[model samples]
Target chain A: MARRPLQEINAGSMADIAFLLLIFFLVTTTMDQDIGILRQLPPPVPEDLETPPVKKRNVYEVLVNSRNQLLVEGERMDIADLKEGAKMFYTNPNKDPDLPILTRQTRGAVEENITLLQQALVKDPKNKQLETDLKKWKGKLSAIELIGEYDELPTSALISLQNDRGTKYAMYISVQNELSAAINELRNELAQDKFGVAYSELNPSVAEDKPKIKAIRAVYPQRISEAEPKDISGN
Target chain B: MSKFTRKGKKGTPAVSTASLPDIIFMLLFFFMVVTVMRQDDPKVSISKPNATETEKLEKKSLVDYINVGTPIDTRFGTEPKIQLDDAFAEVVDIQFWIKENRDRRDEAEKPLITTSLKVDSDVKMGVVTDIKQELREAQALKINYSVNKGSALDNN
Candidate 1:
């Protein structure tokens, strides 16, 4: 007897199988993004170190109580008004004596200061502290020259954020967002004036835009200091 | 006889579907490449707070998540709990978790790892503070407070 002829299996159902898998994956996939406010925490302080003294005028104190009430610079303030208040404190455009002091240093002065620090380093070549100071002074000089605006730089001004343990997380984040927005707003203005672009528009990953970003940041540095929470919880 | 004689009656020619499976497979592969499978199903329910100044986390692999919210499991109680990886964890378990996470990464990428805190808005600051303190001790200084993009003024 002759051998039975071979029969080909149907492949018409393959599309249906693939369709089932595609639907399964489409339903199961989550396109949620990962985004947030980036922050760097201060390192643990050493036990034997002495606390540095900060002047009352130099610190913009922001306190949030257990009830989520905001006390900004010893005055009760609504959360909505925080950004404007922070911008005022940082910029001090009017040079108000009550606000943080802004030291107007010219390019000549910074260059001279850098020379003096360098001369001091020459005497004690191994002085790491002096070397760092020189480097910082040089950076300031570049920043001052890069930004053609006024030489007014916040000498010692910083925002001190303090909160009660019972404060709601949403309130805390709101405060943080305001503070960040304040700095970013200032940077945007400065970047717009100097570089003809917003601060956020400058790509930090690019080599040409690095100095522009650094200059803007140097002009309005984010000096928010998050202090340890006090025992103000109602519970 | 004409070269073009009338053809005999015949049924309509069927449209070829030989390429249908290939097209489906192409779509399947597209979804497979673009899809990021959920790594850990969060046991805690999280509703992130809103913020205006949020930055997109660039590298997902370099970020380790610490979820803080009310647990979905009622047996654990309604109080805000910390979820590390697959299970609920205490504040103290953070250090060990950080170490384990660090050990699994490449040496060069270890320092770049960021700890993203996915905390519910309604949770108290105390729990968040405790986690931050533990993170500082663990020397995982870089952190991202995960939040949705919205106006801070709207929060008030």
Candidate 2:
């Protein structure tokens, strides 16, 4: 005898269940991706070490008062002009006497220094300082290899960012953003000029782009020194 | 005699919804994949300042957020308060929070964790400076200042 036709299971409730779940997720979960300005804080300073004096020309001073006014390089300026001023200070294109000095380093000079450091390391064998110096010179040699033989490096330029205690967080971030933008713009231009690619396009995580990114970063290192906030507001 | 006769009493056929469950399931899966679960309900209401040079924070799991702003409850007063996880905290609590969070992570992932500071725009820098000092003391140096993506001019 033939069996009776089997009945189909109802799936009408399945859609309702899925809709409920979807609504729950939509309400509970945040869709906005977290984006931000990345920064690395300097380690706490030791009491014994004295602060090194930076040359006046090498320091690009950016002061933000509590009143949200910007004092850039001893000149009162608007927020919009800060990026250009920073770029000018960083590049020092005209070899201005007031701007940061750009020292040219030849490949031969870097290699010679590396060899000397290596010889010194061999003799001491346990000198951590010599080892670190050797590693640094080797890094410089590789960076020089990537970009041409001789390059003018901003060896001592540092952007000093000082803010008042009463300074608004918004103004502080805006200043920081401009400083980062200045560095990024310089890197972007250099990357485009050297590798025919934007700096943002080269990811350090990728093997091939690692050296390119390194070379770019080595040429234009981010050297923003944030001073401890004081009552710079002059209240 | 006709081999087949036409049926005349039939009404218009109802639309088939056999694939409705499948469509809803697809949407449900999409939401599930993209959804980032809310980890902490911020006690301090933060309206992040705007910045031009913003970057996407990769690996959300590796980021611990520290919210700073005016406390939502007026009973705490108007001063900007720091929020560590779900509850309001002081500047001094950052070190302990960092240690606790770092200890929870795997050994290899400890150094890779980032601290994202979600500070309000109207807040003063004094509180932020205190937090930074606290972070530096704790040796949690890698930080990201959470900001809205906008042009620098917009900030002015």
Candidate 3:
């Protein structure tokens, strides 16, 4: 019996199969680009823990009620202006000398202290006191520089975000985002002014420029303190 | 000049069908890599609020989603509720879920895990705050408040 040669499989249908699969995926697939505001929740406090008293001047209080109305530092404000308001509060550029000065001294004193520490360190390389003092002075110098540019030192400014229990989630998130944007804007401005680079371009993965970014972050750390949700009806 | 005239005479020679499959296959692979299947079908309708200062959640694997919105089905009632995974859950369930998710991850990766709260704009802050408190107790501090992109001026 003569064996019939195997028939050649049709290659023409391969393209059709590929097209079918492609279309199936195209119909079912959804690209996930998850974008949102990243935040770090404060660690839970003990019920017995007493709330520390914050100076009225230092605390930049932002309140959102059930109606999504904003009460910023006791005055009504629009959400559109929250960023600028937050920036102004954080930088406190026109810092009244009459206001109780926190530990921060004049910018000249910080700079002079830093220079003296550097000279002392050079004279006594093994002096741990000199090393620590130099570090402290350097930190103050950055804070001073940040204050000089933004008006208020970032470290000294505390943002307290409070919302009513009945406040819409949308309003709460909007306020939080605005506060973050203010801090980010300040950082970006500092990065641009000092390093001549955009804040988005400052990658921690890059070794050489990491310190510059770290210094900026140290100066304008995100200091949002979320207060417990209050009952609007009760108050 | 003579070679060019001869090539033009063929009039685009049936535009080779040989690479058709390869082209289609390339697209298929591209979609396969980029496509992320919806992990949980939301039981409640969620219309997220918009914000200008949004950051993209970088690692998908390290993120867990907590959805909060009013139930779409009438049987569940008109009031808003929290949906953990596939089922309706209370605020207290957040700690349990966080622990379960944390346990599933490798010890080294546990710290990087973030809980993305996809809360509906219409939901009240009371529920969200409760959820946040539970998360804090569970030591899942990192959170991403999921929102759509919108201009700051739109708040008005």
On DockQ, the candidate that comes out on top is 2
Q: Higher-DockQ candidate among 1 and 3? A: 1
Candidate 2 chain B lowest-lDDT run of ten: B1-10
Q: List the residue pairs that clash in candidate 1.
A: none
Isolated chain A TM-score, each model: 0.90, 0.94, 0.73
How far is A26's C-alpha from truth in model 2 (Å)? 2.0
Q: What is the lDDT of residue A137 in candidate 3?
A: 65
Clashes of 2: 0
- Please write out the lDDT profile of model 3 over residues A19-43, one tens digit for every residue: 9988888877878588899999988
lDDT of 1 at B14: 100
State every prediction's TM-score relative to the real structure.
0.92, 0.95, 0.82
**TM-score (C-alpha, index-matched) for candidate 3:** 0.82
The sequence of per-residue lDDT tens digits that candidate 2 reaches over residues A63-118 is 99889999988999999999999888877889899997787778889988988888
Candidate 1 lDDT tens digits, A151-184: 5655567899999888999999999999999999
Each model's lDDT comes to 0.89, 0.88, 0.82
lDDT of 3 by residue, B5-54 (tens): 64434454577788888988999999877777667888999988988888
In order, the candidates keep a fraction of the true contacts of 0.84, 0.88, 0.82
Ranking by DockQ: 2, 1, 3
Candidate 1 residue lDDT tens string, B1-156: 787786888888999998999999999998887787777999999999999899999888889999999999988999999999898999999999999999999999988999999999999999999999899999999999999998867764
Q: Candidate 2, which segments miss by more than 4 Å at Cα? A: A150-154, B1-6
